[model samples]
Target: MIRFENVSVTYEDATETALHHVDAHIPEGELCLLVGPSGVGKSTLLGTVSGLVPHFTGGTLRGRVTVAGRDTRTHKPRELADVVGTVGQDPLAHFVTDTVEDELAYGMESLGLPPGTMRRRVEETLDLLGLNELRDRPIATLSGGQQQRVAIGSVLTPHPRVLVLDEPTSALDPGAAEEVLAVLQRLVHDLGTTVLMAEHRLERVVQYADQVLLLPSPGAPARLGDPAELMAVSPVRPPVVELGALADWSPLPLSVRDARRRAAPLRARLEGRTPPAAPAPAPEAPVLAQTARLTLLRERVTALHEVTLALRAGETVALMGRNGAGKSTLLGSLVGLHAPTSGSVSVGGAAPHRTRPAELLRHAGLVPQEPRDLLYADTVARECSSADRDAGAEPGTCRALVSELLPGIPDGTHPRDLSEGQRLALALAIVLTAGPPLLLLDEPTRGLDYAAKSRLVALLRDLAARGHGTVLATHDVELAAEVAHRVVILAQGEIVADGPTGEIVTSSPAFAPQTSKILAPEPWLTVPQVREAL
Candidate 1:
């Protein structure tokens, strides 16, 4: 069992304690979920189990953290490595080896395991994770999902009694995310390994958690208990739970399947009432931007090849393809971050490359996939206001816009100190506050929970309603289906498919929705949508 006895943790160079006298226990062989809004010390709490908080990160640690009956303070990461395996938000950050086989063996080899044992464990993990086919492949060549699995497999090869994963699926598409989660579920059910995970996207994993730890805010204490109880008290509850609350159901459902099971009676009662009118069809989209014979050259890579497309106003366009299919590069080319090798790209009738970066802020705003790097401000409020003022926005309007985007952030908190999700939200707020006519978002929902994602979707929908043209490049097909009017698939630096979101997702095997793979023929994005659809 892992036990935290009144553990209060403060990072170096920070005034506030990330964890506050937190007492928690994660029993051996139990799946524990550490969940919270951005920057509530969930990651810190997980770090304690792996001896990373005070040992590796140089934090002020109080109280005792005991794992597998060993005091964590006495055990360094390598000393406790065999007992506890940790996977962080960016899986690629930890990799030291080139191939999948070497990665899995690295951990075991460090533990002084025999060559035979390492080889056997490596092969076992490869087969267990379905990486046998790609065992010899370079880590750089694997897809995001594949890389994440390899990371997990590498850690698990040590045969740790406890596995701690921090937002493992945040960077993956829903389909790929589901695949990773399935492997984790198998580890718990089959191997009886205690799985403790901290994630923002609760809707995807909440159903699998045996226990839930809900952290309210940064510097605040966390509450731990039953999943249902945690959800009941959580301010950032999933839409399915919210729908259950609205339906007045006792003991809210955690999964869509559970919600469906309970909604039969609720549906019968709701069927008695008159249903609301169908939503008006979205306005016919008109071309707002165009790329004619566009080409992008990135060192030795040809990111885009003679790509031609039109993005219409009031249209939500999603760019979908496997990683390295040049999704990020294509989006970069659109914003002049990567100047086109040949041909022209125009936004709102202005040439993309010719427009100054500051001038482009008036016509288009690009939210890069990795938004944390975009933030350099001291405080969240200041950060949000900085870009808007740079773009000549009114101070009041900028504040108003920031408040709308992140209602959770306090006024004076340091922007750099905010959690990854909150920082992403802050970056998006900075871009949106500029009030650009064309908005480009690359993987906007990477580290957000269902509540945050819904808020983002609603915000984007409102933006589209207000006539802003939004282009979202993402692996999230669910997000695409709900918000986008059209889906554009890019493969091998060329446009493979472009059409209506529903048509593209529902009909194409290569471009199908991930949510549909879980619960088919539903045509829904949220649990509420599923409930309503049925």
Candidate 2:
């Protein structure tokens, strides 16, 4: 269904080809998984299949590309829309309608489908994606994960023969991600649809892929082969694969079930052994932020309800919950973006809502879900320079932080030109340069690959060691297992569970990491834990 003929893409002013000369074939009805580190041209390659490279992105395509037998070079994106359904990393950019139901119907309307057929598809999609409850909600009001599902449903309703998704489940919670992936699986098995997906969270989708397509690095040819064969050599792999390697399991396991099936002897070896204790703030550590009975409402909807939480110096807390469950709202309240309907929130001994903008920088700083919200400069260097100026830091302070978090970023490259993970790293560097007593990050690992995420974990650990307080709101359970000392789970704008990282995630099946699930009854949360135990 999709074919790349010696494809290579070079954007205007780019120093290197985003994608090197590559050739691969994705037969019809196959779920092809694209694997690569961030900014290595996964997105650029996906654009070629959907004809968005040269047509919409102003890049030069040197080799031929085709989708459903139509050459993408000759066919524009709109021309191939009927045969291809593309969902990019950023979901908000894909919406044209205000409400959930309208957005789903709009795509079919564009295709000039019959009214009855459109209505039937809309209902099917809403139910298939579990968006029936959100059908009437305005797109702007939905949470990031909810918005992601709506964006996906909008495309699926078109029922294109080929589906191209970039980070489709990046914003979704565990349950929602499974539902969406199951829907895609159904499409491939029952409807004979083709899916080409690129995702950073391999643990969630790698098991479902029939073929793995890898863009190893910049200026490197792509490789297409069996999932297990490619994954054994892929730099980016899921926790199960990592564990399989750690234990020397032949033919690496791709899913938790497969890993668990082979973990009996390993589990016996780990009996009575304890994982490292989660990090904790010192008893004498100062309290940096406190929310006392905080209640917040937005547009007559309660975003946070009577949530009382506290963060101490040297503590890292992860705020986790399903989409639209008040995680982002709580982060917003910490940064003074939302005024609580009742109760109070304080950072560094001052109410965040009452603190002045310049003063708030000294107290706390927030890197929101949309990193672009904090970035205004044109070039990467200018953004760092501006961050230094705004934070009252010495020259090169922010640049050094950027170099640590996101190395190899060009000084003159546009901030908008960077990949999703690169952009987040830049935004994080800008915020961290302030050196605030408290740090707040919402969905910090959205587009970051494993290597980038490891750097982030190290950076956050360093910050915590230096006595900085961090409140991270994320759906990446593995990330929480790695960095968060404590976790707070919210539901329907209320805090339901708050405990240490190992206890909370391991106790809950929905929130447990892959290793934890595989090593169940052992209380393991990560590959390192299992490795250490053995």
Candidate 3:
């Protein structure tokens, strides 16, 4: 069990407290979900459980925090490793070994468990997380979802009484995310493990939470209660919850099945009405980029096959697929991070791989899967300044854009200290400063909440309206449905389907959004679209 009494945290340089007088108790063997907007201290609260807040993070803790009756204020993360296991957003940052089996055993080895015990736990964890097939693969070689499972398995091997996860399923595809959530459910139901997780993709996990913790904003007291009660008032909500609210359903439905069961009348009301039409394809638009029979291989692995694609100005393409389906790889090829082993790729009439860095920025700008890769300055102010100089923009252009995208982020804040969503916003501002003809974003909504994601959707739409070609690789089906003009799906390094967004998503059960699933055969992909129809 975890308990926080008048707990508050303030970093060394921060003026505002990350958490404010948070008093909550998470019962043993229960799964508690921490929900909040971006930069609202969800991660800060999770860190307090494992004593990472004041101990390793160099912060000041105000009151008592205990895990399994041990005061976390007095104990360090290492001291509580036996009872508390924490997995952060970045799985690569947590790994100490090269392969899956070794990573799983590393934590136990550090805990000084006997070799026999460690070996048995490793095998058990691999099986529990369904990583048997990838047990021998290098951690770096696995897809984002596989790496996430490996990260969770590495911590689960220790068999800690309390498991703390931050954005555990953000990187996973729909099926893999369900597997991870099911694993958590089993841990709570069968193993009696206390699971505390923070995730932005509420549609995937809210239904499974035993209780919900809402941290509305920084310096605000937390709210803990039944999931339905909190979701009714929570600013950040999943599509199902939003739909329930729209229909005025009592005890807002948290899952798709429940919402569907209650949607019969609404379906009847919508029987004769048609959903809004998707954007018409622009057959006469100029081609801004093209890849002809592109093939890419890395470490004897075929990441992308001989694939041909084209992006026209004013088009927004959503590249979607399962984990390890080469979405990221395809994005990389577009930005010249990976040169095609065969065929050609052209953006703005030149090969991206052959163009210089500065010149490349003129033709295309990429916001990679890891947003921090594009950020290097010590402070946000300097990062903006550097972006301005590199792009030859007006002195305040980057800063202005940052303000528009991430509003309240302080200029003095360290880039590393910003939340994942904030960091992505800053990275996106830097890329947009260049005014490139083509834009590439991979998993842009990884840590963004509903509000931030809405702003992103609007920004992308604005860019598309300005005749910029945009390609986004993401697993967020709702996001793709809302923003993309076209949808392209890839599988096993080959293009499986490419067409208008409505056609590609509504036709496929696996790719359909929550609203589409609830309003079955209705051709609706979002809550807004359904609301418009009604």
Largest lDDT belongs to which candidate? 2
TM-score of model 3 vs. true structure: 0.98
Clashes of each: 0, 0, 0
User: What does candidate 1's lDDT look like per residue over 433-509, in tens digits?
Assistant: 77888899888887776667778989988887777888888876667867887789888788988987766887764
Best by TM-score: 2
Q: Estimated TM-score per prediction?
A: 0.82, 0.99, 0.98
Question: Mind sharing the TM-score for model 2?
Answer: 0.99
Model 3: runs farther than 4 Å from truth? none
> What does candidate 1 score on TM?
0.82
- lDDT (Cα, tens digit) per residue for candidate 3, span 190-306: 989999999999999999999999998777789899999999999899999999998999999999999999999888888888777656447999898899999999879999998
The order of the candidates by TM-score, greatest first, is 2, 3, 1
Clashing pairs in 3: none
Model 2 per-residue lDDT tens digits across residues 14-92: 8888899889999999999999999899999999999999898897899899888899989989999999999998888
Per-model lDDT = 0.77, 0.92, 0.90
